[model samples]
Target chain A: MLELHQISKHYQPGGQLIEALKPISLTIKAGEYLAITGTSGSGKSTLMNILGLLDLPSRGDYLLDGVAISSMNDQQLSQIRSEKIGFVFQSFHLLNHKTALENVMLPQTFGTVPLSDIRQRATHLLQQVGLAERIQHKPAELSGGQRQRVAIARALMNQPKVLLADEPTGNLDSQTTLEVMALLEALNQQGQTLILVTHEPEIARRARRCLVLRDGEVVSDHLQRCTDPTQF
Target chain B: MTAQAKFYYLHNHLRSCLNELRSHALRSMLTTLGIVIAVAGVISIVAITEGMNHSLVKNFSQLGTETMMVRQNIFKAMNNDVLQPMTEREWFALQNLQTGISAVAAFSRVELPGTGVSGVRISYAGRSQIGRLLATSANLPQMTGRYPIDGRYFADSDSDARRRVCLVSEELAATLNLQLGANKPLLQIGNFQLQVIGIMPGGNRDILGTSADVYLPLGFAMQLNPKDIALEFGFRSLDESNTEHIKRQVNQLLRQIQGTRPNETANFVIENATELKQFQTDTLGTIRTVLLLVIAISLIVGCIGIMNVMLASVSERTREIGLLRAIGASQSYIQSLVLTEAAILTTVGALAGILLGLGIATIIAAGIPQIEQVILPPAAVVLTVCCAILVGIACGALPARKAALLSPITALNLE
Candidate 1:
């Protein structure tokens, strides 16, 4: 489980104070499929960044699995991120120079795993994501959906309990988006907690819970069936 | 982390660094140019310096290590201070001492009395060229191993009688068609004429030099101008091991003959060929030190150049660095990645520079060669490359630190 107690982000450009995220408290239980939907500049990206531990909150506290994140140093934060959190960006942020298998093996490079095991596990993850035949393709060589699939495989390389995806299907065509969403849903069904950041209502309708944010504040937090949110 | 995990991490970092270079080959080459030039400079300078040392040692070998050059006012040669000259009687007394020395020659440099021309003119069958005049004793060949190889040396009788006869080395003989035991054998030195009784067989190569030489007796040299002939003595011992003893004996005899008080510093200097060789070696060593300092400075500049490029590379890869941070790469990992890239660039440059420098050195050595051929010492090449690697690490440090210090969010937002 992940928990936030009134976590908010503030920054200043030159001398003007800007509140990017307002004080809000929230929590998500284990194995929950959560969608955070917001328009442009609705602080959804900022919230995802804080959830992934990419940035520290200007105020408030964050705890994951009952361990306080506010007091950890950068290196300790990195260890926790590697061991407990997985991040998937909208651009599919796979290193352009590496092949699919190499990208999948990257997270383990920073871990305490032996090389031989990392290789085997990377190969198995690619297979689990239906990319066994495309393991050698670089990002440029793969289709949009295939690249997103590789990113998903790489994210699952360390087997993190919490997966944070910021618009995983944002760059794909509609048909490929369905395939990527299906893969994500399958991983969620297997009990990995999934947190998706998107602005599309149709995509948010598939989540077990939806949180709509506006003007740096959470406007709505409600549970929904797999297909009920389009009727909102 | 465990050692195995560290190795695994290093392996991946090395692979990615190499991949980064492969993707941007031209930029890598440009960044490494300074290292290439630096390594090449060091290697070639060392090669030539080593080559010159070999030739000087060879020359010293031919000089015969036991040989000594005795000169007055040698220590104060830079000044015009007057010294007590060795009289003819004193030279004979030192030569008769039955000391460690086997052969010795006292030479006097003189010009023709009326004409100021330093060399004498010889005309045989209308072939006229200026030849050097050396006033020497009969043991000319034994003193320095430069003797007449073709004809004959000066006999003691010729020096005793103060004969107006002279011997010409073959190097001078070829110019005038001079011969031994000819019906007509005479050359003109100014208005005074002398008969050429013998031809001296000459060595093609001499330690100092082999030139057109006309040998005259000491009596004949005194006949030119006894007052102005600057005198210098040279001697060689049968046993090189007893040179110090011979030098002491010569000094004592000279002091007794010149009548200097016991406590006064002797004005003459005795320099042996081995000592000269050591001096040459020391001089060359000094030159090598100075050159190495200059090369080290240039290499430092090369290091700074690499640092500048590393800074540029780190700033350019901001987004990638952030991604690595987000993916849980530690600060040390990012730092190592940057350093690894710099090290790879410098290694490639240094290797290429070694080849280029050695190739150029080989061409130079081939063009100008000594009796003993020379090549670069392998240890120097190895050390230079190791120095390059060290410089490369220093060059990458600042940039790697800068990259490691960037906040993951700030870096990810950098365009």
Candidate 2:
């Protein structure tokens, strides 16, 4: 469960104040599949960063499971991010020098998890993402779809409570997009909380609920029907 | 975390750092060159100084730590009217002192050709040679703490009786084909015929001009220039511990004999083997300090080179830093990673430098026979290594801070 009260973010570049996100309040319960859709200037990515705890809202009183995020320090926030939230970036962001398995094990490196357990779980997660045969391959050696799958498995390494994906299929082909969507759909069916940020309407429709933003403000929130078949 | 987990954490970081450096081997080597040179320079300097100190100690030990020598201060003698020539009475007074002086000998010299120029003409059998000449008391060997190499030293009776007996250096004896036997070989010096009583060890000339090729009785030499040459005294203390005490007592006695007041500076200078060694050590210490300072400046430059490379690395790895931060690495963790990389780089450089430095020192020592046993002092090695690591850490600080302070979102946004 997560809640945001009057959250707003602003930036100053070259002595000019620019409002990246206007004050808005929102909440998402556990196990909800949600998508945020917006145009180029919309605050979708900013909102996703705030939700993932990667960036702080300039004026916000964010609550995660009734705990105020504002009261926590950087170290505490980092710990919460490692344990409770996982991110899937559009570019994959996998370390090019490491194998897919090492990339998947990256999150647990900062924790007290034993090396053996971390290796074992990363291998299992890679298998779950249908990357079992390609665990040893580096990101540069994998196809775009396979790289994205590796990123997905890495995001799941810590068994985070909320999975936040930012344009997960932005670089994949249409066929690979279907497979990724089916994977997300199956995860959502298993009571996993999912939050996605995308500009594509069809991709946004796959989620059970969608929010559209215009000019740093949410304009609409509605439930959607997923008509695509799960062939993955 | 458990201790085992902590170990694994550190082990992983170390491995990661090694991997990163290996990937950029050329850059790493280039970055370490400054450190290598700085460390090598310091090591070589230390080795050379230590070798010089060792030889100096050996020379002083040969003269004996307990030995004391008194010489007229030429500057004081010229400037002050109170300077008085030491007489036989003063010599008797010094020998009578109860200040643990074991033996005392009085001697003086005049350059045979007068100031600056040296050497005296001598003849033996049918050969003639030029050599340095000195006049000394019969117990000069005991007072100066150096014994003859081949034969016995002259006796006090010989000095008191004005016997025409003398010692010749091994070099002079060898040149004249003289050998010690039942019948002592006689040599002609000026207007006297003196028997060779002993052979002194041959060596380089000393500051006191005592290592002459030929020595004559003080009693006989004083007869040559009774009013022109001032006598210099050498005293042997009972042991090293008594030298300082005897020296002060003798200084007072000399002042008393001159009738100079207690507050007035003495016209004579008192020197001991111990003081000579201390002066030598102090001089060497100053030289070492200056050399180390020059090396330190070079080391700082080397560290700056390291810092420059680290700054570039921080910028190049900005995205990686962000990813690590986003994945739950603390800012301090990122800082430590960069610092560790720098430390490892300098450590490698230091090791290589130690090898190179020892090699350089060995080559230099081999070239100089005086410092034949050069050993690297352990303190110098420890000091240089510790300095390298500390400098490495200091150089890494700025770049590590830069990397740690980067905002994760901004870093992630970079392509």
Candidate 3:
């Protein structure tokens, strides 16, 4: 579960104030598939960053699993991010120097997890994503779809409760996008909450709930029917 | 972290960096060149200072343990030109003077015919040999700490009988090819037929590389060679204390014997062991300071080299650092990694420098005729190594800090 109250993020560009995220409020329950969609410069990425705890809100309180994280230190924020949330990027930012398996094991190094256990979990996640044969390949050696799969495996390394995908299919072909979307759907079915950020209507269509933003404020919230809420 | 865990972390960091360095072997070797030159500079300077110190101590020890030279005036030249020699009256006055006066000896120079070298033409036959020949009472040996290496020195009986027996230096005996048991009497010079009684050990050679000459009994020397009058005087003391006081008293006594005016400058000089030691220490100190300055310049150049290479390494590993930081490595961890690389490089270089320095020192010391042994003090080696390590750490600080401060997001984006 996550809640944002009166969230706002402002920046000074060329000495003029620009509000990246206007005052807004939102909430999502556990095991839900949500998508935040907007056009370029519409603050969807800013909202996503705030949700991921990668950036601080200018004026807001963020409650994640009932703990207020607005005033926490950087180290504490990092700890919560490591333990409670996992991130996937559009670029599939897998470390170029590491193999797929090592990239998956990266997040585990930040937590108290045993190295052997982390390795085992990463291997299983890679297998679940149909990348078992490609675990030893570096990001440059893998296809876009395969690299996204490795990124997904890395996000799950600490067994975080929420998976945040920021334009996960932005760099992939249509077929690879469908494959990555299917993998996200399968992960949602396994009871992990998924927050997908995208600009494409087709990508947002896959989510059970869609929140649309125009400028920096939420414009619409819609819920759709899927086979099962638990399956998403 | 626990010490063991910290050690493990350091070990892993060093191992990874070393592996990377090995992959870029030429770059790594170039990086280490600076450290090598810096450490070598330190080692060479220290070795030279040690050599000079050794020579000073050896020469000082050879010049009698507690001896003090008392002449007419503090400012006078060693070779007296104006002052009269110490006569019997002045010696009697010195015998009664307090303040630890031990024994007095009168020194002069002379020349003689070459003994047992038949048909061999000698150069400068009319000129004085200018050998330091001492004329003293039987107590001269006790005062000077000089003992015969063969045969014997003059006895009290010899002094009383005014016998003309002579003691030569080992070098002088070797020069004249005079064997210890040879039946020939020592060559006659003036009225005395000086029998060769003994040979003294070779000491600090003069500028011409010649050892000191023969000794003769005071009574016999004064009686046989009255006109060979270029005299230099010495006084051995019972203890080093009161040497200054005795020197003053002896100066006053000399002035009284010479019957000079109160402010008239005397011809002879008075030199104390403390002054000699101070002179030696100051000379060595100056040499050491100059050497250290040169070493410092080399170390600075070495540090500059280290900085240049480290900056290049930082650029090469920019993406690697970003990856680590993204994966939760703290800035401190990145800094530690770079610093560890520097320490390892310098430590290895220091070890090499010490061995090389000692090897060179050994060779130089072995080849020199004066040095009997070459000793590499452990302190010198330790100091040099520490200096090198400190240089590494100092040179690494800025680069490590720069690496640590790199933004993970930007670094991750760098190709």
Worst 10 residues of 3 chain B by lDDT: B116-125
Better of 1 and 2 by TM-score: 1
The better candidate by lDDT, 2 or 3, is 2
Give candidate 2's error at residue A106 in angstroms: 1.8
The DockQ leader among the candidates is: 1
Ranking by TM-score: 1, 2, 3
Docking class of 1: acceptable
| lDDT (Cα, tens digit) per residue for candidate 1, span B1-415 | 7787778767766766887888788889998898998888778778877877766766676677778877776555456555766657767786797867765677765567543343556666678876567677787667766566655677778888888877777767887777766464878877777787766665122323322367778877776677765566777877787888888888888887778789866767787887867876787799879987887888888888889988998888888888889888879878888888888888888988888777777776654423134468999878877877777788998999999988887887665
Native interface contacts kept by each candidate, as a fraction: 0.51, 0.42, 0.06
In terms of lDDT, model 1 sits at: 0.79
* Stretches of model 1 off by over 4 angstroms after superposition: A225-232, B54-275, B351-356, B368-383
Model 1: lDDT of residue B278? 82
- Model 1 complex DockQ against the native: 0.35
Stretches of candidate 3 off by over 4 Å are A98-102, A108-144, A225-232, B1-29, B51-63, B66-281, B304-323, B331-407, B413-415
Best by lDDT: 2
lDDT (Cα, tens digit) per residue for candidate 1, span A57-121: 99998989889999998888888888888888778887887899989998887665666888899
TM-score for candidate 3, residues paired by index: 0.61
Per-prediction TM-score: 0.69, 0.68, 0.61
User: Chain A in model 1: its TM-score?
Assistant: 0.96
lDDT of 3 by residue, A130-175 (tens): 9999989988999999999999988887778789898999999999
